[model samples]
Target: MASWRISGSRALLTAGVALTAVFTATLPAQAAHAPGGVDDWGTVVDTKDCVQADAWLVRVKGLGKIIDTKLFQSHYPTTPQAPKQHAGGRELINLAPMGIGLGKVSALYSRAMGHAHPATTSGKGDVPARGEVYADAGGAAVDIGLPYIQNPAGGTQLSPFGVHVEGITVSAYSQPGKPVAFTGGAARGYISVAGTRIIDIPPIWAVNLGVRIPEDYTQAPLALATTNEQVTTDVKGNPTKGPNGAYKYDPKATSGYVNGIHASVLGTDVADVTVVHAAVLRDPKITDKFAVAPRAASDRAGVPARPLSKSCAPFAPPRTAAAGMKDTSSCW
Candidate 1:
C-alpha cells in the first residue's frame, strides 16, 4: 500500500482530537455531505490526490508546530481496490476547532482537503483540493487573541465563528501525455443546515469576523485566502515538453499547494510556531503498486457521461495559456 506518515516526538494535533461537542453526534451521518459531488471512494486513477493545506498562521510560544499537520501535508495516491488500501489518496474528514486555553479559552479551526483523482461516480467526498475557515455561528465562541502579548490588541485578534463562507476548492485530472486539467472557485455564503452540525457555538462576547492585526504589525494579516496552487513535471519528476511543443504538467509529476489556509490569534515574532509548522513535508516520493493509467485524452468519444450529484454541480476543465492546446472535460 502507498502511504506516508509524519513521525516526530513533537505534539502534533489531529482532527480526531479536541472534537468533543454535542454537534459531533450528527457528524457520522453528515460526513457524506461534501461541497461538490466528490466522494471518498470510486475507481480513481492517474490522479495527484496528495496536496492539501488546512491552516497557516503563527501562534505564540511554540504552539504552531502542534496543530494538525496530517491533513495539511501531502499524501501520495494509492488504489482503493488494492489489497492494502490506506488513508492517503482518500478524502479526510473535516477538522474541528482546536482549543487554545490561554487567558481565556480560544478556539482555532482550519478546514482543508488535498487533491485526488476525478470522481468516476457520484457520491460524497472532498472537492479534490479544498480549504475553508469557520467564520459563523457554527464555530467557537471566543476570539483567538495573542495570549503572550501584554496587550491583546497588540497581536492578532480573530474569531473562528464569525462570518459564513462556502470556502475554496481545486480539482484536477490528466493523462500520461496531456496537460493536467484543473478547476475551482471561492464560495462565500452562510452556513447551510447540513454544516451546522459541524459546529454551532454562538459567541459569548462581541466577537468580530476575519483577521485583526494590530497597527504595530507590518504584515497584512488575512482572515482567509483561497488555495489554487499547483506544480507539474514529467514521468521522471523533472520538467518536460508536451506534444504541443510547450511545457506540460503530467499527473505523475504534478504537485499542488494550498497555502494561507490559516487563522491565528498571534503573529510569531519570537517563538518558533511560525518558524517550524507541523504540516511541512520535504522531497517526498510516490509509490502506488496498484496504480492504473488514465484514459487517453483523445478517447473521450466513448467515455460514459456521468450525472451530476444533486448536492454538487459540474465544473469545466482547466484553461492553459499554451497556444494550440485545448483542455476540456466534465468534473464532479
Candidate 2:
C-alpha cells in the first residue's frame, strides 16, 4: 500500500509553483494499454509519433518569482516498455525565512520517483492510421523537511518535521481519428510530522482542476490535454469564427498530462512539484496524407467524435488497493 513514511532524509522537487511531498512507484514491463497486470503509479504517457514524461524534485518561488533553482530532473521519451525513474538530494538550504522556500529547515532534503510509458498497437489495413495508443506514469513520490516553520502571519506553526507524498499518476489513451481520453490522480498518500503519520490526504483528479472546462473538459494542476475538436483561437486568446458563422476549431492537435503536489505555507505558494507528466499531440493534416481512406468524408459530414468522460482512472500505486481508482469502463 502507498503510505507516507517519514525518515531521516527525504527531498522534494517540481517543475513550477508550490512545493509539496510526492511519491512514486516503479514501472512495469507490460504497457498500460494491456488488459491487466499494469501497475499505476505516476502519470502515464501518450503519443503522436512523439511523447515525453518528466519528474523532478524542488523548485522554489516567492512573490511570483523563482528563488531556488530547479533540482534533479528526469525526462525521457516514450518507449515500448515502461521505465522507472528516481531523483533526490540532501543538504539543500530552505530559504523560507527569506520568503522564498516552502519551510524553514536549515538542511532541507528532497527526492522523487515514478514510472512512464507509451505503447501503441496498430490494426491491419492502415489506411487512415488505425491504432490504439496508451501513455501513463505511476508510482510517484516526493518528500521534504519542515523541522520548523512560520506562517504568513509571522507565528510559529509547529509544522511537521518531514513530509512525504506518494501515489501520483496520469495517463492518456486514444485511437486514430478519435478524441483523446485522459485519466490520472493523486491517491493513497499522506503527510507526516516528527516521523509519525498525521493526516490523510484525499485523492485529487485532474478533471476537478477547472483550468480547462466546457472547452477541454479535464484539467490538472500543471497539465494540459486537447484534441482536434478544440476551438481555434486568435492570438488574443479569443475563439475564431469561420465564414459560416460557426466557431473555427483547429483541425489537428492533442495532448495529455498528470497531476502532482503543490505545497504552500500559510496561504503563500512555495513550490510546484510533480511526480510524473506526459504530453502527446496529433496533427491530422500531416497524419492523414497517407491514410488508406480519405478523412474528408468525416470532415464533410461534420461528425464530431464521442464526448470525453468526466472521470478518469486512478492508475493506482504498486501493491495498493485500487478500490477508489475509477476507470473509463465505457472506453474499454
Candidate 3:
C-alpha cells in the first residue's frame, strides 16, 4: 500500500545519477555475506505463540545554530537542513541499557500476528520511533559532536539459509527523550522423536524442549534518581536552599549505555497455547478488515523456519562479551 518512489523526471534523473555515482564509488566485497562475513536469514520461524517486551530511554541535545547552519549549508544548499537533512546527521548523548520483558501473552500475540500488530499496538506502525529520535537529535547535534555512527559491531544476524535473526545485538549512546532500538539474537532448541505414523503425518516428530540459550541484550532503559543541590543566590550571589530536590533520570538517557537480558519459550504443538493476536486486538472493531491473520499450527510443522546454524564462525560474539568466554555460541 505504501511506496518508496520519488517522483518527477528531474528527481528521477537526479536519483539515478546519484545512485550511479555511489555504486561506482564503492567496490563490492568478495565474501558472500556482508563485510562482517555474517550470512543473513531472510525470514524467522513461525513460532506463533511467544512473548517479548522491552523498554529504553535516551537523551539527545542540539549542537546549536552554528553547527546546524554549517551542516545545513553543506548537505542541503538548496533547502534548509532542518527540513530535509533526511539522512546522516545526528549525535547520541547518553544511552544506558536496561531490561523490559514482554508478558507471555504479549509474545504470543506478536508471533501469531507478525511484527506489524505489536508495532501498531506500541504506537509505532512503521517508523521505529527509537531510531528516528536519535537520528533527529543526533543530526541536530552534529556541530557539537560527530554524526551518529552505527555500531558496526552490533546488528542483525542472517543465517545462510535465509533465517534472519532480527535485532541480534546493537549499541547506542545515551541521550534524553530518545530511545535506542533493540536488536538481539534469538535461538530455540528442542528434541524430536523418530517415529512414523500410518497416514499423512511425517515420520519424524519434533518436540520443543525450550529455548536453549534465550535472547539477551544489555541495552534496555534504566531509571535512576539523583539529587542535585540548586543554591538560590541572592543579589549578592550567596548560597540559599539546601540540596533537597531529587531528579529522576533514565541512566540510558545520559550514558547511551544499555544492558539487557531476555528470555522466552517456544510454543508446544500439543499444548494449544492461548495467544492474543495483536492485529486483531489492536483493531477488534474492524470486521471488514481482519487485522490478525489466523496461523494454523501446520505453519510451524517440520523444521523450524530458522534452524540453528551448524557453526558460529561468521558472527562476532554478543556486544557485552566478558572475558571473551561466552556460555553458548550460535549464529541464530
Superior by lDDT: candidate 2 or candidate 3: 2
TM agreement with the true structure for every prediction:
0.32, 0.37, 0.15
Whichever of 1 and 2 has more lDDT, that candidate is 2
Quote the positional error of residue 40 for candidate 3 in Å: 30
Q: Which candidate is the best by lDDT?
A: 2
Ranking by lDDT: 2, 1, 3
lDDT string for model 1 (1-332, tens) is 11111122221111111111111111122122222332111112243332222122222233433342221211122122111111111122233324443222112122222222223333422222121100000112222222221234542223322222232222223322223333322232221111121222221111011222221237563222112222343322233347996654344433222111122332332221110011211112332221224533332322222213211113221111011112222121
- The order by descending TM-score is 2, 1, 3
C-alpha RMSD in Å of predicted model 1 compared with the true structure: 16.6
After TM-score superposition, the amount by which residue 296's alpha carbon in candidate 3 deviates from its true location, in angstroms, is 7.3
TM-score of 2: 0.37
After superposition, candidate 3 runs with Cα above 4 Å error: 1-60, 66-332
* Candidate 1 vs candidate 3, lDDT winner: 1
* C-alpha RMSD of each candidate structure in angstroms: 16.6, 15.5, 26.2
